[model samples]
Target: MALPTSPPEPARLAGDNWLANCAEWPDLVRQAWRVEALGTIVTGTRWLAAEAPLVVVLAAMKRIPHAELGPVLADPTVEKGWWLVPLDAADHLSDIRQLRVRPPGWPLRCPPTGWQLCGRFWLQPPDGSGLVTAPPLLGAALGPGGPRLPAEAFG
Candidate 1:
């Protein structure tokens, strides 16, 4: 798969108006997004990236009250109403890798596993005007269904 040639858009928070406009988003579409979740509710963030424009919808979910979006986002440490930012893919990924190499809890972590660090990614495109199926990995693990979620189920 080819990497997106266009420059990444600036990071932005999907605010209240944004969420209202997307009230029908998840129901109207089913595109998968690649995202990274970090920090606690008061200061946590989610980074969502997709090949096409639907990334905006995923980011919109971040606007919901934590009590509502929390289960889906599934972060326990965070409080409610956390913020979401749409990241500049290339730059964000690069920064994350660099940080992993020198994380604050380095020695204690033993083997630094940067697996949480998202690199390049691709998501299923929206059909003419319908919800997409499961979001699948486009570059490295493209074969069948969407990218496999972790084995453990979210409660």
Candidate 2:
């Protein structure tokens, strides 16, 4: 799904579907970063904060063509931060399930750090409505090497 170049309206997703407000997009991105950082630290991996990958989330009901997503995933313009992947409903659910499972040597559950950890994928809209101009869907963080989808986030 090709999102509009400009931000969309708030009422666009007002139904019972999960939606992330445009205002909170930054926070969501930050949370994803924190999750990545925490994961690396806990696992004893090298902490390369500046070299963190971008998070890509597939938020739409239909899966985005790999041709389209591939380019975005491989895009070199995005140095650091998370980006939406735009997957279909089925794929989104699958991805979420994969993310929820804690990896070996990782914490069983995310700590109460207030920041939504890896397994915690859903983001509540500020107004408790549908998504807004910026919808927080399944995304992956991009770093120097490649895209890092939220995984082993809790641990």
Candidate 3:
């Protein structure tokens, strides 16, 4: 005789769709599971993020007015942080030598929304509303990185 199968649990069902901001969300969750470190994807869109030392990241976070902050991913192991910003961030932050504005189409590995812990986790997770850091505010907070230096400046 064939046995009946039970449906996936309620919490299991809700968990899967909470961060369904993008179309690939379900697949991304599966990918997160495959990674096993509880990480999700920060991809698509015309956005670019600024990757900087943890200190700088925190500094900017503090400077942003009010209590309103946006999604952020942090990696303690590397002492680095990434902030989700608009597409124009590249030109706005061009002077920042201490940071790197990730090129668009870069698939950043971040923790799924909510309180997830791993080597690389979200400092500020997405709020399920697809909100991102305001570019002008972020730019103002970090100020300018000063002009880019010549290669020999490092040597």
Candidate 4:
């Protein structure tokens, strides 16, 4: 199965307006992006790479406010997760061992906002507001092992 370098001008999505305008996601509306050999050329924002478990740990932790949650993509095959953070997030996440701030112009496999295409799924779908995980908080929560959640975690 050939994944699209771009999905067919993705059908009207919930955050299309913001993605198209605010986020400046290139070719989001005009191009025909489909699951092919490659995915989308994510622009205007940056990404953080980590294991799926750690990403899940961060999402489930009560300490990390729900509002802080942003767009997260999960690759079941690799059990890896991709987080859409502010473009400058690298400065904050670079120090963390469990996470790697993707370099500029990174190509992430973003299938869409609301569906799991192929093995990629959105753990936290984009909402158009463009608010993503707070890097500082993410850094503080991460440890050599993984997220240091409070006693009552994964809620």
Candidate 5:
């Protein structure tokens, strides 16, 4: 699919949100897979690219207490969050290829063997299949920006 020329609108989910407004393309979603974990929380930084807009989805895993503030103190709970960032084929060519060439040690229990380049996002399925570059769509709906996690994701 052609790179979205203009930014799309954003979509909101329970633990995820799209930074850009993108259409809910069934085909793309069908091709997409959920990323359950990462090598480190810092890996989320790699998802951001200047070439194209990326959607970063994050989910909270567990909660912890703030040492500075006691449990009885004001809002002192902290949550461990995971993130999923989508990359565009044209924009993140180098980064995507590099990951495939030399898969990094992400803090995942079962690291991804490879990635699937769907319409606009780089997907990593639970299956161990290697890299897959999707064929371009003639008239695929390229939505706005991309997905993002909630505020808690950063903390």
Candidate 6:
């Protein structure tokens, strides 16, 4: 399969979602991820330190109080360092599953739309051919206070 390709402006922070507050801090906003399939952009934050910045952008776009998305956006682990994995499309899919199944820390969810978001991602430098995969370190921050909300809430 071909690598995913997002729209040129996918990372545009002009939406009403939870991350509208990031506009003021263009530097932080620049690191946002453009999820090609989802057609939206999300800031790659390692902890809650980036929350204030993100909240600002989200509030502006959503035209609401940034506080509304606080709890979800306040997750501390998201502030940790990021990994860059290099893998073909097939390997990417496999690695995603391995990340979800092998490690309990994976923030796995099969949304009604049928797409999965590994809230916690793992990565590494490229291999000899400049291809590497970053798999989440399963239980790093997921043991107790991790980001995975209670399953009951979703049910």
> Which candidate ranks first by TM-score, i.e. highest?
3
Model 4 TM-score relative to the real fold: 0.65
Return the lDDT, model 3, position 53.
95
Q: What is the C-alpha lDDT profile of model 6 across 34-139, one tens digit per residue? A: 3312122222221111112223322322432222222122112353332222222223324332122122122211111111233322111111122212222122
Better of 2 and 6 by lDDT: 2
lDDT (CA) per prediction: 0.23, 0.25, 0.63, 0.56, 0.21, 0.24
Best by lDDT: 3
Which 10 residues in a row give candidate 4 its minimum summed lDDT? 2-11
Model 2: residue 79 alpha-carbon error in angstroms: 3.0
Q: Which stretches of candidate 5 lie over 4 Å from their true place?
A: 1-37, 41-88, 91-124, 133-155
The sequence of per-residue lDDT tens digits that candidate 2 reaches over residues 1-155 is 11122112442233111222222243453354444422122211211011123233323212332323311111123422222222222233234322321222332111112223333321221122321211123222111233343467757
All models, RMSD in angstroms: 18.1, 15.5, 11.4, 6.7, 19.3, 17.5
Question: For residue 39, what is the lDDT in candidate 3?
Answer: 42
TM for every model, in the order presented, reads 0.18, 0.17, 0.68, 0.65, 0.18, 0.16
Candidate 3 accuracy as lDDT? 0.63
lDDT of 3 by residue, 51-131 (tens): 999988888787775345666778788899998777777887777677788886676765554434456666665555456
Evaluated at residue 94, the lDDT of candidate 1 is 33
Backbone clashes per model, in order? 4, 29, 0, 15, 19, 19
Clashes of 3: 0
How much is 52 displaced in model 2, in angstroms?
A: 6.1
lDDT pick, better of 3 and 5: 3
